[model samples]
Target: MPLITLQNVDYSIGGPLLLDNVELSIEPGERIALIGRNGAGKSTLLKLLSGDLRPDDGEVRVEGGVRVSRLEQEVPHGAEGDVFDVVAAGMGELGTWLAEYHHLSHAEHVDTDKLAAVQARIEAANGWSADQRVVETLTRLDLDGEQDFTGLSGGMKRRVLLARALVSAPDVLLLDEPTNHLDIEAIDWLEGFLKAWPGALVFITHDRRFLRALATRIVEIDRGQVTSWPGDWANYERRREERLNAEAQENARFDKLLAQEEVWIRQGIKARRVRDEGRVRRLKAMRVERAQRREQQGNVRMAVALGESSGKKVVEAREVSFDYGGKPMLKALDVTIMRGDRIGLIGPNGSGKTTLIKVLLGELAPTSGEVRLGTNLQVAYFDQYRATLREDWNALENVAEGRDFVEINGKRKHAIGYLQDFLFTPERARAPITRLSGGERNRLLLAKLFAQPSNLLVMDEPTNDLDVETLELLEELLGEYEGTLLLVSHDRDFLDNVVTSTLVMEGDGRVGEYVGGYSDWLRQAGPGQVIAGGGRGAAGVRNAAGVAQDTSSTASGGTGNAAAAAPQATAATAGNASAAPKRKLSYKDARELELLPARIEQLEATLEALAGEMNEPAFYQRDAAAIAAHGSRLGETQQALDAAYARWAELDG
Candidate 1:
C-alpha cells in the first residue's frame, strides 16, 4: 500500500486550473523532489498532500494512522512564544500529555494514576528525550531556544519553523523551500538530517546541491500535469532534455502526417459520399490530437545581455578593518578585485559578509583603511531585502522609477518593453508590488538591476525564492557575463557554477581568500578546521627533502594568491618507486570483460528507448504510476551498466 496517494486530483484558485487530473502515489522511504516554475502549483500540491487544502475533484488519501507534517514558506504570524515551545509543538499528543502531567503535579491533590498514565504514554510515543531533541534541532538550525519567536529575524523565524517540523519525526515530511534562509553550515546539516530520516519525504527546493544529495526521485509539474522521473537533479535534467527532444521529434512527425491528411481532404470529393465523410472526421480528430501534443511542448525563454567591461583592477581594499561597538567585524583585509573575477562570499550567518560589501561600495566607512574603485566602474547592487522597491507602486512603476526609458545596447527602450523582456505581461506590470509572489518580486528586482549597464555586479543572496529554471538561466547568464561579479549565496551549487574563487569570512572578523569553488575550499580546510585567517599550508607545501612545509601566515591581511607564491620542491625531492609489472586477467575474468561492452551497449539502447517512451505525451497522460515504475527500471539498468563498465576497466587496466 502507498503511504500517500492522490487520484485524478484537480485543484484551482479563482478560475485557472492549477492542477488537473494529477495522480501521485508516494511509497514508504521514498525521497521525492517536487519541482516546477514559480506559481506552477508545487506548493499547492504539497498543501493538498498535507491536507491543508482539499482537491476540488477526486481524492487524496493517506494510509490509516499515518502522520503528515508540513513546513510552509511563511512563518506563523502573531505567535507569542519562545522557540523551544514552538518546536515542541510538533510532539502532538505526547506534548499534550507532558503538559497535562506538569499541570496535574502542581495541583494540591496530586493525581498519581493520571501522572503514571501520562508517563506511560510518553514512553510509548518514544518521546522521553523530546525536550533534548527539540533543543538539538533548534541549535542545529541556529535558533536560540529561549528567544522569542516574534522578535526573531525572518531567517531565524524560518529556522524555528523548520525545527518545529523536524522535531516530531513524523511518518511523512513535506517541506517547501526549507533551505531558503540557511547558511552553508545549516544547509549542510539539514541535508544530512533529511538523508538519514526514516520516512517518506517530499520537498520543494531550488538548491541543486540539496536536490542532488537527498532526492531519489524528481516530480515536475508542467502545464497542469505531473511527470515524475526516478533519480537526482542531474539525472532529471539529462532525462528531461532527452524527453523534450523526443517530444519535438514526435510533434514533427505528427505535423507531417497532419499536413498529408489536410492535402487529401482538400481534394474536394463530395461530403455526401460515405468514404469522403469518414475522411473528414478522421482529419478533424488528427487536428485535435496535434493541438494537444503542441500544448505539451511549451518552452521557457531566458536571455541576458552582459554590460561593458571596466579597467583591469575593478576594486581594491587596502588593510580594511571594520568594528561595531568595540567588536571587530572585519580584520585587516587586503584584497584586489580584478575585472572578470567572479568571487563568491561565504561564511556562517552574521559573519560580516554584508559589512564587507558595504565597505566595498563605500556605503559605510571602515573603522580603518581605505577602498579604491577603478576607472569607469559602474556597480549594480542587488540587495537581499529588495529595499529599492516600493510596496505601493505597481511592478512597472517600481522597475521604471526615475526613468522614462532605459538604455540597452546603446539604444533607448521604453520601460514597458523592458518589463516585457523579463516575462512580465502588461497585466502583471500593472499589479502592485505587494501582491507579487516572492519570485515575481525577485524577477522584477533583477529586471531593474540589469536594466542599467554596469561593469560590475554585486548580489547578496540572489538565489532565494528562485525556481530551478531561473537558477539555471541565471547561472548561464553569469557564465557569459564579461564583467566582474561579487556574489554572496548559500547555494553551494550556484557558487560552484558561477564563481571562480571564494572569500571566507570567519565569525571572528578574519577573512581569507581561496582560489576555487566551495568544494575546493572544503578540501583545503580539511576535517574540523574552520576557514579563518590562514594560509594554504594544509593544501600541502613540500620542502627540498620531500617533507611537508608550513607556509602559513599569522597576519590577518593576506592576498588571494597565497598558494601560488609557495616554493616548489626540486627534482631531487621526488621519491623513487618500485615498478610492478601488470598481470593478465584470468580466463573467466577475461571472458566476462569481453562480454561487458556488449551488455553495456544493450543497456544503453534500452535506456534510450525508455526515455523516448517517457517523452510521449500519451504515456504520461495515461498512467503516471506505471511510468514511474519504468523510470525506476531505467535507473536500475543504468546502475548495472555502470558496474559492468567499472569491472571491465579494472580487468583491462
Candidate 2:
C-alpha cells in the first residue's frame, strides 16, 4: 500500500496554479528526489504531503495512522532550549515532560515539586525508552545533548533538527534542502545515514552528489504539473530531454494549424462565407488554448565580464604562516597562483580556508612571509554572507548603484535589462531585497558581481541555494571564463567542474595542493595518505617505512612550477628513526605503568574503528582522497596499537 497519495490535486497561491490536476503516491522504502526551478512549488508539494498545507481542491490520502514528519528548509525563529530538549520535542506530550524534567534537573536551584511531577509523568508514559532513543540519535549524529541549541554551528543545528525528526520514528519523512550548510564530511555522513533509513523518503535538494547517491527515483514539478522519471539521474536526464523536444514539436504543429485557420477567417466576406462553420468554431477554441498555454520559464543567461589581462603571477606567498588566538591557522605555506589558473580551496569548516584566502589577498598580514600581488589585478569577491549586497536596496539599485546603466564588457546596458538576463522579472528586480529567496539573493549577487570585469574572481560557498539548472549555467559560464578563479565551495560536483587544481587544509596550517578536483585529489592522495580536512592525521601520516610523509607538497604541473620549491617527503628519512631509551622508573613512570594496560586497550579499540570505517561498502566508493585519508588514519592507529603492545610487554618482562 502507498504510504501517502494525492489525487486530482489542484493548488494555487493568488496567481497561477502551482499544482494542477496532479496525482502522486509514495511507496514504502522509496527514496524520492524532488526537483524543480526555484519557484516551482517543490516545498509547497512537500508541505501538502506532510499535511502542513491542504490543497485548495484535491484529496490527499494516507494509510491509516501513518505518521508524517518533515524537516523544514529554514530553521524556526525564537526556538530556545538545549539539544536534548529540542530533540525531545518530537515525542509529543511525553517529550514535553522529558524536556521539563531535564531542565529542572540542571537548574541552579531545583524546584523539587515540579521536578517530581515531570518525572511522574515520564514514568506513567514509559518515556524513559523514548528518551534513550533521542540520546542514541544524538550520539549517532555527533550531537551533544547538553549543548545549547542556538550556540551550535549551522551544520550542527541542522543535524539536531534531523535528529529530532528521526526520533519521531515516522513512517514517511520529507526533507527540504537538508545539505544547505553541511561541509563535505557532514554530507558524507548524512548520505550514509539516509541510505540505511527504513522509512519512505521524499527530499528536495540542490546537491547533485547527494541526489545521485540516494535517489531511487526522480520526481519533478514544473508548470503546475508533476512528472516521474524512473531509474537513475542519467536515465532521467536523457528521457527528460526527449520529452521536452517532442512537446515542442507537437506545440509547433498545433500553432501552425491555428495560424492557417486564422488567415482563412480573416479574409474578405466571400472567403469567410466559404469557410466551414465547424472550422471557424475550432479556430476560436484554438485561440483560447494558445492564450492559456503555459510556456516554460526562461533559463538564466549568465556571463562573466573579463577585465584586462593580468600579469602572469596573480599571487605569490613564501613560507606564509598565520596564527589566530595562539593557534596556527596556516603554517609554512609556499604557493603561487598564476593567471588563468582556477584553484579550489577545500577543507573541513574552521580548518582555515577563509583565513588562507584573506592572507593571500593581503587582507590579513601573515605572521612571517613575503606576499606579492600581480599588477593590474581587478579582484571580484562573491562572499557567502552576501556582504556585497545592500539590505536596504532592491535588486536594480544594488546592481545599478544609483546609475541607470552598468557596463558589461565595455557595453553599456540598462540595469533592469541586465537583471532580466539573470531571469529576474521587471517587478521582481525592483522588489525589496528582503523579499527575495535565498536563490534570488544569490542570483542578484552574481548579477552585481559579474557586472564589472575582473581578472581574479574569488567566490566562497557560492552554491548554497541555487537550483540545479542555475548551478549548471554558472558552471558553464565559469568553464569559458578567461581569468584566475579561487573558488571555495562545499559542492563536490561544482569543484569538479570548475577547478583546475585543489588546495586542501589538513589542520594546523597545512594545506596540500593536489591535481584535479575533489575526486582527483582523492585518487592522488590514496587511502590514509592525506586528510583533506584536518579530520584526522593532520600532522602527517606514516607509510610502511614509519616516516611521517609531508602531504602539503605541491604536485608537478601547476602553472607556476611550484613543485620545485616545495619539499617532497622521501624514504631518505627512514634512516633517521630513533627512540629514547628508558633506564629508570620514577613515581610518575610507576603511575603511567599502572595505566598502560587500559591505554593499550584504547589503542586497540581505535584500530577496530578504523577497520570498520574502511570495511563499509561506501568507503571505497568515495574519491581516492577520502579512502586514502581513512587508510592513513587506519595505518596510524594500527602503529600506535602495536607500539602500545610492545611497551606493555617490555615493562611487564
Candidate 3:
C-alpha cells in the first residue's frame, strides 16, 4: 500500500492559486528527489505532505498507522532545549502517554475508574517498551553522544533535526533542503546513512552531488504541474534538454507555417473585392489551431565579459601571515596569481578562504608579509552576503541605477529596458528588491556585476543561490573569460566545469596546489600516493611500475626520472645490490596488501554504477526481480572493498 497519497490537492492565498490540482503519492522505502525553480511551490508541497496545511479541495490519505516527520526551515528550535532534547521531541507524543500510564499504575491512591482506563490505554499503546525504542533511535542519529548539542554549528544542528525526525520511525520522512548548510564530509556521511534507511523519503535539495548520490527518482514541479522522470538527476537533465530542444524545433516549424498562411490570406483577401468564405474559414482554422507561444524564456545565462589582460603578476603574496581575533589562520603563506589564471581555493571550512580573499582584496592587512595587487587590476568581487542590496529599491533601479543613456540595440535605453534583458518583467521590475526570492536576488546581483567591466573576478560561492540555467550561463562565461579569476566554492560541478587549477588549504595555514578537479585531488590524497612518496622501497610500491606508472607521479616520463628523485637510491655511493639483500614478501602478506587500491577502485566503480542504476526508474521497475540480486552484490562488493582498504591502512601503519 502507498504510505501516503494526495489527490487533486489545491491551495490558494487570496484567490491566487499557489498549488493547482497537484497530486502525488509516496510508497514504502522509496527515495524521491523533488526539484523546481524557486517559488514553484516546493515548500508548499512539503507542508501538504506533512499535514501541516490542509488542501482547499480533494483528499489526502495515509495508510493505516503511518506517521510522518517534516523539518521546516522556518521552524525555530523552540525555547532553551538542547539538540538531543529537540530530537527527542519526535517521541514526545508516545513518551507523554507512557509517562502518564506509569504514574497512574504506581500512584499512591489510584481511583478504580482511572486505574482501569490507564491500563486499557497502556495496552493499546504498548507503552511498556517506549524508552528502549527512543534510545535506539537517538543512537542511530548520532545525537546521543555526551557532546553539547546546543553548541553545535549550523550544519550540526541540521543533523540533530534529521535525527529527531528519524527517532519516531515514521512511515514517511519529508526533508526540505536537508543539505543546504552541510560540508562535503557531512554530505558523504548523510549519504551512507540514507542508503541504509528503510523508510520512504521525500527530499527537496539543490545539491546536485547529494541528489546524484541518493535519489532513486526525480520529481519536477513547474507551473502547478508535477512530472516524474525515471532516472536520477543526471539522466533527468539529459531528458529535459532533449524535450526542450524538440519543443523548440516544433515551435519553429509551426511559426514558419503560420507565416506562409498569413501571406496567402493577405494576398488573397486584397485581390478579391470581398473575403472568400473558404479562405477566411481556412485562416480562422489556422489561427485557432496554432498554440500560444510562451512569451517568457525561463533561462538566465551569465555572460561574463573579461577586460583586456594586464601584464603578468595579477596578484602576489609575500610571506603572508594572518591572525583573526588572535588565532593564527595563515602562517607565512606565499602564492602568486597571474593574468588569465583560473584558480580555485579549497579547504575545510574555517581554514580561511574568505580571509585570504580579503587579504588579496586589501580589505584585511596581513600580520607579517604583504599582499600586492598588480597595477591597474580592476577587480569585481561577488560577496557572499547577497542581502547587502537595498531592500526598498525597485529591481530596475537596483540593477540599472536609473541609467537612461545606456546603449542597447544600437540605441540609448532606459533602466526598465535594461532590466527586461535580465528576465524581470515590467511589473516585476517595479517590485521591491526584498520581494525577490534568493535566486532572483542573486540573478540581479550577477546582472549588475557582469554589466561592469573588470580585469579580475573574485567570486565566493557564486553558485550558491543560482538556478541550473544561471549556473550553466556562468560556466560558459567563465570558460570564455580571458581575465584572471579566483574562486572559492564547494560545488564540485561548478569547480570541475570552470576551474583550471586548485589551491587547497591544509591545517595551520599551509597551502598546496593540485592541477585538476576535486576527484583528482582525492585520488592523489589517498594512502598509496602518500606512502609511495618520500623514498619508500618495495613495500611501498604497487605492481604498477615502469611505464605503467601514472603520469602525475613524476614530472618526466622516464624510469630514471623516478629513481633520480629517490633519496634512498642516491646512496649508491654506499653499496651495490649485493651489499643489501632485498627483503622477500610472504605470499599471504603480499596477497593482502597487493590488490587493495585496485579493489577500492573497483568498488568505487560499482558504487557509481549502482547509484546510476537506482536513478533510473525504468531500470528499477523493469528489473524488480534483479533488485536484491544487484543490491546484494553491491553490498558485498562494498564490504570487501572497505575491508581491503582497512587492512591496507593497518599494514601501512
TM-score: which candidate is best?
2
Misplaced by over 4 Å in model 2 are 526-534, 537-653
For residues 475-555, could you state the per-residue lDDT of candidate 2 as single tens digits?
878878899999998887788678889998876678888877765565355334445453554222222101101221111
| TM-score to native of every candidate shown | 0.74, 0.82, 0.70
Question: Which RMSD values do the candidates have, in order?
Answer: 11.7, 11.6, 10.6
Ranking by lDDT: 2, 1, 3
The C-alpha stretches of model 1 lying farther than 4 A from their native spots are 14-16, 91-144, 153-155, 259-275, 286-309, 402-405, 526-653
Tell me which of candidates 1 and 3 scores higher on TM-score. Answer: 1
The best candidate in terms of lDDT: 2
From the highest TM-score down, the ranking of the candidates is: 2, 1, 3
lDDT, residue 11, candidate 3? 82
- In candidate 2, how many clashes are counted? 9
lDDT of 3 by residue, 1-653 (tens): 78888899888764346677777888889899988776677888889888888989978898889999987653354612444456556677665555455456556887778777766776787865655665566677666433466676667778877877887778888998776555544555576678678999998876665666667888887666777887555467668778778978987898798788788667854566665788778777878777433322467634554555676888899999998788777778888888888888766456678888888778899999989988778788786666546777877777677665444324555666666666777888889887887667777777777666688998877776565666767877887788888988767556756777877665566666676544434423423232111232222222222212221111111111121122232233224544655556678877866876676667667655654453342543443235535545555554565565556555443
lDDT of 2: 0.80
Q: lDDT per residue, candidate 1, 1-653, as tens digits?
A: 79899999999886557898999999999999999888889989999999999999999999998888999976766545666667777777775665465556666998899988887888887777885677677777667766777887666777778778888767899999988887776575577667778999999998876776677889999878899999655457668888879978988888898998887766655733545677788889988876664154222333343566688998899999999999898889899999999999987667788888889878899899999988887888898889988888998888778677877767778888788776677888998788888888888888878876787889999988888777877887887778899999988768866788888885467787887666446434432345332222333211110110111101100112212211111111122111334467889988987897788678767755664463343553433345446646655665565566556556655
What's the lDDT for all of these models?
0.73, 0.80, 0.66
